[model samples]
Each structure stands twice: as C-alpha cells, then as structure tokens.
Target: MTAPEDHDYDVIISGASVAGSAAAIMLARRGARVALLERRSDPAAHKVLCTHYLQPCSYPVLDELGLVPALEKAGAVRNEARWYTRWGWIEPKAAPSGPELPYAYNIRRSTLDPMIRSHASGTPGVDLLAGHAVTGVIREAGRTVGVHATGPDGPTELRARLVVGADGKDSPVARFAGIPAKSHENERFSYFAHFRNLPLRDGITHSWFLEPDVAYAMPNDDGVTVVAVIPDKKRLPAFREDLEGAYLDFVRALPDGPAIDAAERITKITGTVNYPLHSRRAGAPGVALIGDAALTSDPLWGVGVGWALQSAQWLAEAVAPALTGRGDVDRALTAYARRHRRGLAGHQHLAADYAKARPFNPFERLMFSAAARDAGMARHMHLFASRIIGPLRFLNPVALARASAVNLRHRGGPSPAPVHLPHPTP
Candidate 1:
C-alpha cells in the first residue's frame, strides 16, 4: 500500500533488531512502506549480552519469515533442553510431531542479528536507516504520528501512520509515549561466557535448578558453548571481588556439572549485575511496543529471541489491515495489545515470581518430581518450558491429577540419590 500524502511511510519501526527487523520484513511483504531505524551505523552490529536461544514455539514464525533455511545454513544448532532438579533429570523423548516441533536453535546473536537485518534491508518497501537514533515522538492531535531522530546526515522527522517501538527494555519510544513499564525486581544477577571444546550430547541445553541459584550450559553453532550462572544476590560480594573465580567455581561445584576446566574460554566473562524484569502497555495511540520493549521477562528461561520473533509477527498481523486502510488503526492496536497480554501475561508473572530467587514452591516440586518419574509428565514439562503452552494449560486438572498419581506411586520408594552441592571451587 502507498503511504498517505502527508506520511513518509506507512509504518516506522524503531530499533532494527530482531523484533523491529522482523516486523519490517513482514509488513513489507504485505506491501506497506516501512522505515526500520537503527542507532548503530554498522550493518553487522550485534547484541553481545544475550542468551540467543530460540524456543520451539518460535519455530513457526521463523519458518513463516523464511529465516529457518538461512539460519540452518549458517550453522544454527537445533536443541532440546535437559533439566536437572533435586528430583532427578527431566529429559523427555524427542517430540513426535514432525520435523520442526522437536527442537529450537541456539545461534549466536553475532550471526542472528545481521542475518535478519539483512533480510529486512533487502526487502522491497523497507528503508533500513542505520545510524538513526530516535530522540522524541511526533504527536499531533494527541496521537503519535511519527518520530524525531538524528541520523548520520542530520536531525530529521519521519512521519508515518503508525510508529512501533521495538527498542528493547527502557524504551525511549515507550517513555516518550507515556507508556510506563511495571517492573518486577529480579533478585538474581547473571554472568556468562563462551567456551570451545565444551561438548554436550546432541547439543541439548542443560539447565540445573539449584534451589535459590541456577546454572545452564547452551551449545551454540561452530562448537561454541555458553555457560552461565544466575546466582542469588547474597553472593554478589564474592562475585564482585573475583568474577571469573566465582563463576568458574560456581559451575564446577554443581552436582555432575560440565567439564568447564577442560574447555577453553573463548570470550571474556561478562553479564548484567542487575536486570529487572519489565512489562509495558503494548501500545498507545499510533505507537506499539514489541520484544523487550513490550516485556522483559527473566532470562533464565531463554525466551527473549523467541518472544521477539513471535511478537513481531503478532504486531504485523494485527495492524496490517489498518495499514492497508481496511480497518481502524486504534482498534487494530487494541487487538494486538489484548492478544499479547493474553498470550504472555501468565508466563511473565510466573517468570517474575521465580526471579525472586526463592526455593521451589510445592507446585513446582510436585511437577518437577513427577516429570522425573514419568515420561508423559516430562513431555508436559518440556512443553511448558519451551513456551509452547501457557501456565493455565500446563496446570490443567488432567496434568495435575497425573502428577499427583506419579508422586503417589513413588512415595514409598527410595528418594532420588542426594546430590552433594559444594561451594565455589577454590
């Protein structure tokens, strides 16, 4: 669709990362003019502080965007996750559903960001404006009409019928639009680095739930493994003194942990000292937020990349009719907001609750224990962990009853062997 005489584009998206770029590509396919603005001038600029894990739920969207083939060609590793709990390891059988449902990818952001951005840049009707930083919103008649940004050339105003903020947590667009984020305090701090020669069977992600602390090792493309630890705030001082020592010791101390010492550290240890989970209104007036700008959940679940792609698809689908002058834009925005909330609110709440670094609640214990004992229960756990199902479905009556039965059958049996969790290795 052609832009209105007064508008430079039909839609202007801020931040050309996963969500922004994906939205641009999808919108352009529908024939809407899109301006994808990125503050970074370099086309290959990528995010470093990320888990880079895509969940199974995001598979369909990636396929729809025609990205899976390129991703696979770029050596993205397909992964299933193996979880370790006090009950035992919960490893479900490979998903029986055809090819795509069984696994997700763990591609480095250095590879992912540029690839999707390239797709957006190459697509017709998308103007990939690199080095453009949005400084403020352009409002007329109390509705957002565009953005004020400065690019490599100079300051300019880009007008559009719709403005999207895919700018990530602490979004300037959201802030400018007066959409305040309701944040949940995260009691854990995260640290991680890449290693080489750190192998895992079938390249499956391995995560350990250590009561108040958590650790995981994710295998990435080209033989790179990302090992991370999310420790409770109480241990912050020790880590502050010696980040590497504390990180290595923490991993080495996990029961049946990986052979970190044998692997070579390829990247400098880095992480966020404090990352508060945040959520905001999906949109207001002519503005819509996607990806981390819409909601920043706990990183422990590795939902960032998957959510980014899915939310972009959601936004494009929701507002495409309006972009084509077939429906009211405000109504479309409302629909998108409702859809996003219904889809992610429960997951976000649970993730935030767990981010408090607390011990397992009774429900979690029951489910984890049952998953350890029963293959069916393990599959349900996998489905939930992969974000393929919501918490309500995950805790349905049938599932709850099944878990109870599994635990009852194992009640008199000897408990799973106790694990000796040691302190940080010296």
Candidate 2:
C-alpha cells in the first residue's frame, strides 16, 4: 500500500488558493510531501468576484491551520445574518448550539487568498510552485499517476501518488481527467460594489429574500461594506441599459437597507451575468477534485468559501493515512468523496433549487413566516442558514410540526402579501 518511491510527491494539488493551499498545509502537517501548484505568478493575486463570506463550518479548519488569528489580525469581521422576509425580519437572538452568537467571518478574498497561499508556501514538505499550470494529467494503466504542467521553467511533468484538482468552476484538471460536470443554469444575475463609511452595524449582515430576487449588505474588513443585488434574469435588460443606475436603485429600494446614498463608493460595480451550478464526481482513479472542481452551487447561500475550506480539510484527513502507507490510497480517496457527498448533498440540492429564481414554495413560506414570529423557529433557521447544521436536521419532522403550529395560531386573519419593489421600465 506504500506510495511509489520514485514519485516526486505523495500529493500534487493544482490551484493553490483556498482549497489547494489548505490541502497542502494539512497534508504536509501529516508528514506527506505536497506540491502546491498555482498558475498565477504574482503572490498577491486574489479572486475579486467573490462573496468573501465564510460560514462557521469552516472555522475549525482555519483554527487547525493556525490561520484564524492571522485572519482576525488582518481585519476579518464576525457577522450573524439577519434575513428580511415578507413576514418580517427573522433574527435569532441566540445561537441554538450554544450561548455564543451565531456568526460567520467576512474578509475580502483579495486579502484571504494570498494569506493562506503564503502559509502553504512556508509549510515544511510543501513545494509551492507558483506559475505552474496543470495542462493535463499523467495516466498510466488506467490510473492518474501525475500531471503535465507549464511553469516558468517551461513544460514539466511531475509524478505523484495522487493528483488533486482544487481549481475553480471551469476546472481544467477535471476536464483532462474526463470527469464531466452536471450543470444547472441559474436564472439570476448579480451586481455588487464595495463602499466606505456606510452606517451599517458591525457584527450583523443583512439579507432580503425578496421572493425571486435577493440582496445583502455585508460588512467586512477596514470599514469596507459589500452591497449586492441578485435579481431575476427578467431585470437583466434594465441592468444592461443602465448598470450603475439600476444597481443603485435596487439597493436603495431594499426594505430598511443600507444608507448607500451617503456612503462613498470605493470600487466599480462588479457583475456576474451567469454563474451556473455544477456538480461532478468527487474523484476518478487516483485523481480527486476538491472545492469548486467537485461542486459549484448557488452563491446566493454564500457557501463557496466555506465549502472550499471544509472540503480541503475532509480530503486531507481522509487521504493522509493512506499517503503515509497505512492503507489503500484509492480506497481512502473514495471514502473522502463519500464523506463530502454525505455532508453537503442536501445543502446543494436546496441551493440549486432556489437558484432557479422560483417563488418560495409552501414549505419555505411556512418556515420563513413562522421564524419571523417565533424565537425558537428563528434560531433553528439561523442554524441552518449559517451552515452549522445540515438540511435533514433543519427540516426534521419536529421542526416542521412546530412551524405548522406556529402558522395555525396566526390563522385568525388573512396573511399579508410579500412586498415587491417596482422595477423600472427598460
């Protein structure tokens, strides 16, 4: 079960960003030699078009890497989200899990990515190969043995016991491995910008579930606030006609939204026309795909950063013992894939369904309406949205019954219709 002694490394991870760097650091800590490859030559380069939200689920992984302190020092903000629904604001006064507040970390990826990649580079047993792009895989005897990459030194082939694809959505490694993704089209587009001196409360992120449309204001490092609008595709024409004007009007129309009119806009409005949800098999042969390479779901839930970090932790823990010659490496990778699916499948299913820009169904209406009136229901919802608990737990029979009872008590009067902002004629 030992790894090939002739191999250059036990694990070669492509795309040294959130997932790749975390995987390299965790594997190296377990005494495995790792090659962390990144295509970008600049060490400070980071992803700009990102929500920059990390759910509480990823905190344990960050703590293990000893990066939490560094992140906090670099101005990461801890924020609990408040959701605005037709019924009212569903705000949980306390976290159901404990006395601690339910909060996630928000830090711009421009600061987060390079910081973690730097950690990987400094770790022992990890060769941080910047400017190395994995162009293809090395297949031998129907198993992936390594990768063919282009670097500053020119085209090179590095053999490894296992290859990991941690690249983002359009993963070249997955494509090279012939692992096709099942994509789901999203019916919404997004526009956001960073602002300064916005009079928003610290430690609280605000979100509005405007039925088919969604919006949020997230406060992050150094007084920078991210104000975003994710509207259904029907509004696309208007956005295309007057991008900034439409964007600003959407934010201003949010019920009790941020005072963006007075806040200084610090950056140009960034927009995403289409971000399709994709899911692929976690691995094939000796190659494993982590992060977005494995699955890309709706960003409306802000699950990207957390899932990336969490998947890396899972992969390292599952494959480390095998890389050290304790068991079959392929079997270990399979176990990692199974664990990943079991942990995230429900969340992904719900997220993808919502990404279709459909109206809130009966169950969602029941839950959201009940959560607005009942503290217990609100706390349960907070736990689910924070990604601290999975869907099964969140939708348990007991919770459903409770929500039903909460709604029945309010049946004396007709329910108020959801408020919708009037869209400007294109």
Candidate 3:
C-alpha cells in the first residue's frame, strides 16, 4: 500500500485522549512524525465523564510539556486535597512539620482534554486526523508496522514503526494485539456530574469516606464543582433509574450533607455501574498501551488522570532511545513495561486492597483518628492520601505503633472499632 502524501507518520496513536495527545506532543516535539487518530470529528469535543482531578506530581510533566500555563488559562484550579474520615478532616499540613508536596489541580476534562489535543495538533511533525477510526494493526512478520483505518474518505492506511494504544479501558488495539487484562471487580458504581453555585471549601479537594460508600466534591475553576457518588453495585440499578436524584440522595446522606447544594446541576448526572478496575501488562512486540488502556485503578483515589499523563511520559522516555535506533525495540519495550509496573504496581496493589469491602487496618484507623485530634497527624495523613507517600510509610512499624497507641487511648480499648463516617454531600 502506498503511504498517503504528507501523512507518513513515524507513530500512529489510536485514541486522541489525554495519553494519545500527550504522546503525540512528546514524539512530535522530539521531531518524530506522529499521526493522532480520533473517531470524533470535532476538534473541540471533550470527555465530560471524567472526574478531572490530577495529582500534584503530574504538574512536572505538564510544566515540561509547557501545558501548565495553557491549563491555567483554560480555567483549571490549583487545590490541595483533604481526606475526611469518621474521625475528622485531614487537611494539608504546613511544610517542615509535614511532607512537603505540591498541590493538585482540578480542571474540567471538557477543558483540559481539548487544550492538550489542540496543542498536540499544532505541534510540528504531528498530524491530527479526526473522524478516523483504526480498524486493525498492520504487521510484517510479527512486528507492528502500520495501521489500517477508515477515515473521512474511504479506506486509508498509514505506516509507522510504532503503534500506541491509548483508546482507554476497552482499547481495540489492546484487544487486537491479544494482550490479556486482569480485572478486579468491586461492589460499587459511580455517578458524577458538574455543577455551579456549590459552596466549596477554597483550595481543597474533599473526599468523604462513608464505609462501603464514597463521595467526593472537587472545586474547579469558574465556580464549577464536580461531585461523584460511588455506591455499592447492588444500588446501581436504582441509580440507573434516576441518576441525578440518586446521586443527590447519596450526597445528602453524608455527615455535612451534600456539598453540591450550593451549586446547581449544570450537567446531567452520568453513571457507570459495576465498573471493574483492570490492569494489563502494557507492552508486546511493537505495540504498547498507555493510560486506562494499560492500567485502570480505582477511581476512589482520583489517580486516573495523573496516572494517564505519567504513563505517557514514562512510555516516551522508555521508547525514545529505541525509536531513535540507539537500542533494541523489544528490550526497550520490556524495560518500559518494567518501569511502568514498578512505578504503579505498589499504588495499584494498595488500591486493590482497599477496594475490598473490609475494615480499615490499624494504621488507617490511627491515621484517621489522629487526624481528627491532632493537626500534625492531619498533615501526615494528607500527604499519604495525596499519594506522596507509599503505603509502606504508613504501615511501617513506627507509624503502626503510633496509630495503635492513639487508637487504644482514644477508644479506651486495645481494639478500636472501625468508625463509619457519613458520606459527604455531592
């Protein structure tokens, strides 16, 4: 097949979401030709369903990509995160006394996704093809060599040395490549939306831990707030009937009532039921997956967007040498997989542990109880909650001992019962 003129890209990325766009930006900036394909025709089209919360660690990559300024101009809000348990609110602690960390940003996916996509499309050596869907990967003797796609015109083919699957949770490229995905099912579903007029706590992303149920109220730019209700999957059917009302009720059940009361629902309530968090081994031969297509963690932690961007960065760094012919592609891909696994496997493992409907461990109990009583503890708890610290830090013998002593003293017993915090208002 003859390559399309002005369309012979070094890489063809399927799914023009955050990961794909970010990869395109990175590859194109390095002078590698890239073609980003999206099924949607509108360049301005956005993903409205995302929670839109990104961790502070992701800021470095955004800055490196020169996207922080653009994101700021796009009305993204910089905010610290707060964890609410039955014990109390764990607010961001002051530096020196606590873990020094950066604050995260809450931007509407509707705004952020498009901004990244637009910037990527404008980069030199990058071609953006909207309304195009990749049908299959073209392979030569077992190596991914190109892509066959259906575009605005009839059938079209584009050749590339590498093919990236950024098509999200159910990526067709991942399926076509025969990569197996292992998923852990949870007894929960998520209902989310954007609202205006909600009285939000300034500079803080709030999460309320209602046992077996979770709710979050994130304040974004432009007086907009995003709220989500994660209810047990059994209750999912009822939510399907009246998503908005169900979400509202779930929020109202929280200790401080629904946080979204001040804000009017500007968008319809959307719901996803029995959504399983899946993690797949990311690389095989000439193909690799990034973002949700690679690994999906529990949304309760708000790690999706940050992980997506971080994974894209990792993939680029891992493969750039190979793309430039300095290393073996297979070796580079293996190294990339190893790096990806090492970076997130711990976090995902912790998330999966918490995903189970089980009582909080001693450390969690202590941390929450202490955060309720001591401002110092609150800061530490915030750091861990922000994912600035690994689970091992919290579960260390010293920390665990402190938590046990605190719990015993507070509860007046050796074993303190798990405290059930009310869900926050959405």
Candidate 4:
C-alpha cells in the first residue's frame, strides 16, 4: 500500500452524511481546514429507508446554516404531527401550558442528503473526498492523529489533530478507537417505503399507536409518502418471508385513518429485520462520534435526524475552543462527551424504556388515555411527543398528581391496576 505524504487538516471527518456534512459546513465557515471523506462515490446518494422528518426546532439550525431556502426550493413541506392513539388524535396544545414549539417538517432523505452534501462540497475551507473507504484510524502515543483510507489512487493517509467518526450506526472509527458503548436491545423490526399517488390529509405527519404495534405516515415533497411499520421482533420472520404483504397488512391494521386509506403502494415494500435500537457514549482520545454512531435512539419517536444535527451542533460548540487554540484537545473531547451524555441521558433512557414491549407506565397510560378522551389533553401530549416539552415538564409532581387523580376517579377508587399490553414479538 502506497501511503501519501502526511497531510495535516484541522479536522478529518469520516462519513459525509448529515452530521458530518453539517459539522464540515459549520467548521469550514469558521475558517477551519477540513477534509470530509465518504465511502460512496456518489455524494448525492440517499438512504432509502429513513423517514426524513425534520422537527420544527431543527429549522433554526438549518436557517443558521443558510439551508432553509435551499431545502424549501427543493420542495420540502412544513408539517405538524397528528398522533393517533387509542385515546384520540392529539393536537398541538396552546402555550403557557404546552411545549415551546409545536410543528415540524417532512422531507425525503433522497432530497435532503444530496442538498446537504452539495452545500458541504462547496463550502470554503472544506475538501470533499468521495469514494474513499477508511481502513483504520492512525494513533500515536495513545492519541488519535489521523486516518488510513483507500481511494481510487490506492491507500492514502490523511493526518489531522482531530479525527471525527461521523459514520452511521456501525462505525468503524468508533470500534477502532475502543470507545465502550452501552447498549439496550429492543425487540422490534421496521418495514418502510416511499409511496406516491397517496391522498394525504393536509401536510401533517401521522403516527398510530395501535396498542402493541406502531406505524407512522410522513407526507413529504413531490407527493411522496413514507410509511414505516415497527412491530415486535418475533413477527419479523413472517414479515420477511412476505415483505410486501406484511407491510400492507401492518398499515391496513392501524386504526382506520385517511392517510392510510389514501396511500397507494407505488414502490416496493422494504423491511429491516430485527432492527436493534441502542445508544452509545461516543468519545475517547482524539476521536468522537456523532449521529447514529454516537447514539441510535428508538426511531418510533422520529428523533434520529433531529438528534443527529443537534449532536453535531453540540460537538462543534464544544470543540470550538480547542480547535481555536484555547483548551487541551483531549480535555475538550472529554467535556464534549460529558455534555452529550448529560443532555441526552434522560431522553435516551425514556426512549429505551418505551422501546420495550412492556406494560405502559401509569403516566403514559393516563396521559394517552386522556388524550383519547379530550382534545385539550391530546394537545398536551403532542407537545411532549414533539419534544417541545421535556419529560420532566410533563412528568412533574403537579402533572403526575393530576393524572393520577384522574385515573383514580375513573377507577372509582385510589387503587387501579396497570394496563397490560402484548410484548412486541422477538
């Protein structure tokens, strides 16, 4: 293998997906020399399986990066979420009592990935290198110094002070860096596809929690709709055998809804079997992980893209001081990891809990049940679901006590049995 002369960069980012591209754009704008490497030759290539929904809160970041107009011009659709539970459709609750922001947007990854990659490629101080597969990370004196990659010109070595692993779920850099990741397995699988000719209601994303089974329909630009079926893992083998039939059955089973009825299967049904969702604390030495590489939350909440961008933003903010010659790089990395864990710990914990096909907690049961019975309560639940309100805000003593009181009254006594739901097949 011929190794090129050691080239130095302020930052070397592996994986040119959303997080990596976002970081490259931000850093380049700040005058940092960046080398962005992608294993795929086509930078515009998109992940066909993702929902591609962007939360309203994520708009500010896209706006700050000057990407909102580009995305809008690309046919992005602004949407609000409509959740279907056994209770009812939860609407956005009014302020002074609900979340800070209540709406989001839906766009296809096919459109989003290319848009981001193009923007990053043109950003000043950012060198975009495609068709390069990273072989391993180069470490010196226990510090990450660079990366070893194979490109069209054969094996090449790129050195940098900071090496970032922005690769997705199964990141080679994170594994090579020996960052210990704590994982919780969920007994679930997801089948998703994009469809056209679907008569959608308004421009809202719809989610149906059909007891043990869950489904989501996100209407995107170009009259295309993304429908995902998340079922217990035990059902996966059967679904795999008849992917198309299984997907149709799963969607049809959801409580009769306009979006589902109007959706016409215009594309082949694709499924991911036994898709384990987990979160990992990604940081060590000269390397850090962002996006799915850092933490893969349950997609049921549709927070992957939002969290990916948010994590990249967090990493950029934390590393700015070190990158600009203010603090020790290693120390900065540690701080970034800590802040990441602190900010997402609670959220991930809750998400993981819900990922399991377990009986619903009193709070969840009460809130969802109330939402079904009352539009006002549904609005409150929507705020919490959209992440406008943190878990604590909704689970505070006052809220809990109020919900419990309602449960007690409904049961005619203080003691009530917990609601039991079938565990997702695994």
Kindly list the per-residue Cα lDDT of model 1 for residues 1-426, writing each as its tens digit. 224767999999999999999999999998789999999999889989999899888998899899999999999988778888888888878556634335679999999999999999999999999999999999988899999999989999999889999999989999999999999999999999999998776667899998888989998888899999988888888888888889988988887788999999999999998999999999788999999999999998899989998899999999998887646787899999999999999999999999998988889988999998898899899899999999999999999999999999988877664343455533
lDDT of 1 at 60: 88
Q: Model 4: residues >4 Å from true position, as ranges?
A: 1-7, 93-100, 259-263, 373-379, 405-426
Clash totals, every prediction: 0, 0, 9, 5
The candidate that achieves the highest TM-score relative to the unseen native structure: 2
List, residue by residue over 1-426, the lDDT tens digit for candidate 2.
334688999999999999999999999999899999999999998888888899988888889999988988999998678899999999887745669755659999989999999999999999999999999999988889899999998999999889999999999999999999998899999999999988675447899999899999999988799988999999999999999889988988999989989999999999799999999889678899999999998888888999999999999999999898646888988999999999888899888898989889988999999999999899899888878899999989999999999999999877778767779666
lDDT of 1 at 195: 95
Shift of residue 170 alpha carbon in model 2, Å:
0.5
Global CA lDDT of candidate 1, please?
A: 0.90
TM-score of each: 0.96, 0.97, 0.90, 0.89
> Ten consecutive residues with minimal summed lDDT in candidate 2?
95-104
lDDT of each residue in 321-344, candidate 4, tens digit only = 677653576787888889878767
